[model samples]
Target: MQTENVTKYIVNWLKDYASNAKVNGFVVGVSGGIDSAVTSSLCAETGLKVLCIEMPIHQAASHVTRAHEHITQLKERYSNVSDTRVDLTPVFEEFKTEVSLEGKQATVDMALANTRARLRMTTLYYHAGLLGLLVAGTGNKVEDFGVGFYTKYGDGGVDLSPIADLMKSEVYAVGEYLRVPHSIMEAAPSDGLFGDARSDEDQIGASYPELEWAMQMQDEGKSLEDFEGRQKEAFKIYMDYNRRNQHKMIPIPICEIPNKFR
Candidate 1:
């Protein structure tokens, strides 16, 4: 696709929606990854007031560096862009420990990781509420829908999603067009949730390109056997993620028969 046009479309979309809402501006969580970097740039280009929040919850050193660098670049480029760093380590720890000590069910690793995302979500909304700005989301189509990789009610919660329609590859193309920092564009994708800093591939079981290809084929009504050999593995990973996380991708199921009477 024409990435230049895509960039313009996203920039204009942000501008239009923010104007229609008549809010203060946009609030984005800068995660120091390609998705967040690209989304931040697009929001800045809108020329509306933009707040780039670096909410680091026990993040890696490199994560801090990249987020700071990107925020610095944003400040240099846009007069409307504003930013602040909020460390959430203590908050996350307190919440987790307090729940366990109160005789509540023990929180598993996965549940705790999800809590981290929800914490970030709460922080973003807190700023947006006080500032009267919409929380601009950074999830792409692949991660948000294809594999349902995002944490539900956490990273998945947002007022608006600028890149939710674009696949992972398409997002990178738009990032290049927007002149996103080369280092960020080339960096390995991570959710920044784990203690060890695992890449997205390590967590998702397939590279983005692989997921994109498999998702494309599924959308096209093609069988996995069409791309036999090495691709079979990618397809399998895609199916596994989709099957396990399908609930996150769809709306909460309701009892239709009982509801119909209402």
Candidate 2:
């Protein structure tokens, strides 16, 4: 679909979500990346109070700087928007102490990364609950649905996802249509966990364009027969992530007991 139509669809979608949930606004984390920037812009355009949180740990100064720049640009374009920065160093340190009792430091990197994300989610949900607003997730089709590049109950948890159906390239198209700052649009995408330690491309060993192409093929019902052995293997990895993280994409389950009938 065209950018304009997509934007309209997103705006209307948010409106419907707000009306149904009885929320006055929406909250999103702005990580100085294209996806978050695009999602924030869409939320602002929907006429809801858009709260952008810049949650950076000790290692992510660069990402936090860019987040400020993006927020400035956003404020110029939309009226009902505000931003706040919360350093997550202390929380992460505490979490590390709590988990270090296991004597397993090998997973510390991944655990810290997830802690940062979950801290941001906690803050977002806190403010969202106070304002009676929904939390907007910034993940795209390539990451969340295809590759599962989010932490469970952390960044993956949200009330709504505006860009969940759009690929990374399409997200950039929407960003361009909305005139998102060139700096943000061109900056490398990262979770800002380790301060240039690892980027999305670095972890996945592929660029967004390549990942998007693979995702499109899968979406179109293409099977392993349509790809080479290596490609099929990579596709299997992606599909496995999606399958394993299904619980993260859904609501928590509840148990029920049968009642005797008269």
Candidate 3:
């Protein structure tokens, strides 16, 4: 679809969903990335009150800087846009110290990262409750479904996923169409979950375009041997991630009972 059409479609969907749910507006955690930028712009486009938040838990300076720029851009572009910055480092530290690894039965790095996501989720909900807004997620198709890259009950917990159907490349297209800041459009995509500021590709082992192509091939039931050289390597990485993260993609299973028995 054309970018204009895509933008209109998502905006309409947001409006309809909110109206039916009786929610006042949208709240999104801006990571200074294209996905969140596009999502925020779409929410702002709906003429509803939009709160762009930055909850940093030992977040890098560069990421926070970009976030401020993005929030400023949004405020300039849309009257409904407002911004807030809440440092989650102290909260995360307190929680970390209080909860021992022995008690949680989890590793330090992963548990901390997941805790960061959950902390942001908590901040979002806290603000949402105060303002009567629904949490708007920024996860795109590849990250949300293809690789299951988000933390369950963390970034995964959202009232609406406006861009979840669009792939990473498709999200860039929407960002361009919305005239999102060039810095964000060109910046390396990252979850900003780590202290060293690792890009998503650094962790995922492939670029968004590469993963997108692999996902397409996976959906088509095509063999990895369909391509040669580096493309095949990408496919292998995609498959590995896909296999390991399938649990995140699938819904929780439920038992069925007969109505007659009830």
Candidate 4:
């Protein structure tokens, strides 16, 4: 890939889109992950007002440290970049109190984890509406398209996704070119929705490189019969996720009315 050209193209695209939409700037939820760091940097390069928001709900200390470090560095490097921290822990707790925590333990835990993401999404949109900014999504190709790892109507809710086409490795490359904070660039990729330091790999059971390979194979129409041992296992994992999360990757289902009914 032409790294420099791609970088310039994305920056120009963002600027043009914002100008066409008549929005003052973009609001990105910075999670101290490679995706958000790279995204916020691209928005800053547009020379438009970019707001980096930190909405933490029972977030791990390392994640918090990295988020603050990245935001501070971004503000220092780009005059148009600004930031605000919203502590959503209390709000999350209050919400839990109002909802029933019934059902299986694992199921309840998963639901709460998704709730954290939704709360952060709401916060980002709230700021976007108030500041006349577009909600910039930080999802990458693997998560957004390959695995569908993000929460729908949560982190998946966005006005625009600047990095959705870039693979995870490509996102890291862009982050390197953008000079994202070292702490964030090196930290294990995570959703940070579970309020723990567990990496995305732990949840997905496959590293990004492995998933990328599987995605490529799937794209090439390869199937389980073609591989053995670890490759088969990895391929199966990728296929399972892709199959189950097709809803996220496809358009929402709408019932069409019959001609006679109209």
* Candidate with the greatest TM-score versus the true structure: 4
Please give each candidate's TM-score: 0.93, 0.88, 0.94, 0.99
lDDT per residue for candidate 3 within 1-63, as digits (tens), equals 688898999999999999998988999999888888999999999999999999988887878
Q: With candidate 2 superimposed using the best TM-score fit, by how many Å does residue 200's alpha carbon deviate from the native? A: 0.4
* Candidate 3: regions farther than 4 A off: 101-106, 257-262
| Candidate 1 C-alpha lDDT tens digits along 30-141 | 9889999988899998899999998888888887888888899899989999998788999998897777534334347677888889999999999999999999989999
Which predicted model would earn the best lDDT? Answer: 4
After superposition on all CA atoms, how large is the RMSD of candidate 3?
A: 2.2
lDDT of each: 0.88, 0.82, 0.90, 0.94
Ranking by lDDT: 4, 3, 1, 2
Residue pairs with colliding backbones in model 4 are none
Better of 2 and 3 by TM-score: 3
Residue-by-residue lDDT tens digits, candidate 4, 128-225: 99999999999999999999999999999999999999999999898989898888888999999988999999999999999999999999999999
Candidate 2 local lDDT, 206-255, one digit each (tens): 67776777777777988767788767766665666667777766668976
Supply every candidate's count of residue pairs whose N, Cα or C atoms clash at under 3 angstroms.
0, 0, 0, 0
Off by over 4 Å in 4: none
